[model samples]
Target: MQDDQNRLNPSPRQESILVCVSYGPNSERLIRRGWELANAFQASLTILTVDAQDDNQYSEARETNMSLWESLSKKIQAEFLVAKNRSRNVAKTIAEAAKEKQVTQIVIGQSARSRWEEIAGDSIINGILREIEHVDIHVVAVQREIPLQQEDYEPGVQAYLVKDGEQDILQFDPPAKDAVQGLFFQSIYTDFNNGVFKVTEPGKVTKYQIFDGTVTRKLSETFSP
Candidate 1:
């Protein structure tokens, strides 16, 4: 009778949740959702990001996003992991990480591709399902308030911002002492270097409006969160 009672009341299985994110505005939403699930289940939480390039080769935007994610993970008392995928197989990397972490649940953002694209076997979720077994996956749909807009500026170029007295000057030449390295996007409508300058410093990402090679205002002021 005792053996049968013990068998009927099995111990609850421990749960670990892994959240996969990329460099985008939607990453924070996904992380928060993961946090909610982790709290509800009283499980360990982890934030994982897969990079296709080396750490030194990451773009300014990617670096900034990583920094932000790391800070957020720390705040939530979760482990932040960055995995390099030299072969660019992101799903395989994620699955490997999940196995290594003994994760029981995964939370990922829904792909922006249309249903047709997903049906054609281009979805990463499909690959992950094939790679892992006995793990629950949650695909969160990201809602966009506005449709993606066409580019109003030229492609971003590696540039530097040098402090010139009280103002900052944007230059294409090599960085000088006390210079901030970032990506500069020039407005295609004008001939001068007028657009936006983006830079990541420590735990913060800042953007400045540049007009005629000079910073006009802090663009981050207009950003929401």
Candidate 2:
């Protein structure tokens, strides 16, 4: 495999390489692959992510993943960049970054989208090819994360969390008068009380998980007044 790669490239040194990553567990793999290639060629490596909105506009999970990716990039001695593409043209943003960095090679994950899906909206891979010139684009195949079995909790039902003494228990039925009310989403296939309970805040709806039989701290704060 090494000989094949060496022969294909002839000159085995790449000056600058950029990796484009999206949200999800596949990002780690993309970064590692990019790092390996960069190290092999003694090239500069940069990681880039494009978002339609600012970080604050994204979910906590998205922010957490971004932080993780940034930390991993630092550990690998690669530059990390994020661009806000309000028009949602992720390919154009990445292409622009590649041009600015003078990236000789670009590494991106293969799209999980099916053929029909690509027909609806042009694939990001195709978009990048059209926008960039003379850059060797390496498409890394990625595995989709298997979702966890939802057998730990009962099927979701409209429920409520009621404070009993110092603890809060989930009630599948409606609460009595003056009882703190919120929308409860139960987990699948369990007898015990569990899953996220959502309550409206001043301007947003905050969700808290009910573990065992208690309201989380965030839930407590929402109804403190």
Candidate 3:
């Protein structure tokens, strides 16, 4: 099952990441952050939704929102994660998944409540911290308030696809980074090549014409493969 070709560029058992999604006002925000951290580490992601005992019957609403969120995640360039729901031992389930999946990092949405308050209240996150201790954890604050959208802003850490006609990575010595309007989403002329693509950060232009709808996995054919 392990062909040399297939084993090429083996990803060092990529650190799987578990993202806990509480279907509250912060679910979308947390998932957005989950995608960001996962991409940065080149790790796989798992989305878990916990069903805490609540007063409202939100099954239908949760499903619809999750469906829309999943569909919208594809366009954001995140390696889509499948959703899992559980009605009991939510924190324990998250910890179990992390161990079973060989997860290296757990990304959680930092809540705005004290640990005591969370413990006394219905908070899966605080419980998770108490239950899991084997993996590295990253907590992201939902500072922007608004969820990220394709038209608005792209997450800083993201991957790209290499189409058949793509130019790969562009080497440009920009006059200055401030010259471009966007830090990681500005277009480039490519020396009159009639090609325009996003200027990845610092100053690397990735042409829009080349990627044939496949995620880029090669640094150079000689070394990458």
Candidate 4:
């Protein structure tokens, strides 16, 4: 009788979360906020990005940005997905992914890039709300960065990292040859060695976020319960 009753009761429902990110400087903030929400709900999180064009249309910078976001997603222990819009709209693509993942909550940034505006109308948020039913959406406010009057970062250059004390420090002009080669991006309006570093592994690429002069390899490492 006890065994039968336990089987009939079943386990509690698990929370499912989705975060939609438009590629931009503000995407990092959006991902962090989503992580916080997922932590609060004790939910499984998924990060999704949709491109209007096919994979062949992506430029080097676009590819780098996608890899960086994916790295960020893994750091937060969320599944990362990238989808292309062939026939449907961006909102529709997002809604489909949400439904597939059984997402109960969604997080998106209010300050999406202008490219998104060109592809979808200003009513993108409204469209998403209409498509997704019974799901809560959080619109996060992003502080926009002023575009540089002059070129801030040199064209993305080859750089690598070296172990220093407790953190991996990026060396732009390495004295030693055979250094691990990776693409380096510099941020505008900042004099410090700041931006994203990308390295390609066997079947995937890993992004190391650089701030001031330091970065944490911890984020790239797998998460544990």
| lDDT, each prediction | 0.79, 0.70, 0.48, 0.72
**Global lDDT of model 4:** 0.72
lDDT of 2 by residue, 94-198 (tens): 889999999989988765333313433767777778999888989888765446552434444566677787766777667674455667666442234545677
Q: Candidate 4 has what TM-score?
A: 0.63
On residues 1-225, what C-alpha lDDT tens digit does candidate 1 reach at each position?
989988999888899999998765467678778998999999999999987767567588886677667766866789999998886667788899999999999998774323313434567777788899989999888743233385666898999999989878898999648799999988654455667898966667888877558776666833233
lDDT of 3 by residue, 49-162 (tens): 544535355577666546644543554444444334444555666666677677777776665223223544656555666777657776666433234333333233232322
For candidate 4, write residues 64-131 as lDDT tens digits.
67777776665567899988888547778888898899988888877663445567764667777778
**Pick by TM-score: 1 or 3, better one:** 1
Q: List the residue pairs that clash in candidate 3.
A: 162-211, 162-212, 163-210, 163-211, 163-212, 165-210, 166-210
> Could you tell me which residue pairs clash in candidate 4?
none
Q: Which of the numbered candidates is closest to the native, going by highest TM-score? A: 4
Give the clashing residue pairs of candidate 2, or none.
153-188, 153-189, 153-190, 154-187, 154-189, 154-190
Model 3, C-alpha of 202: deviation from truth (Å): 46
TM-score ranking of the models: 4, 1, 2, 3
Clashes of 2: 6
lDDT score at residue 80, model 2, on the 0-100 scale: 95
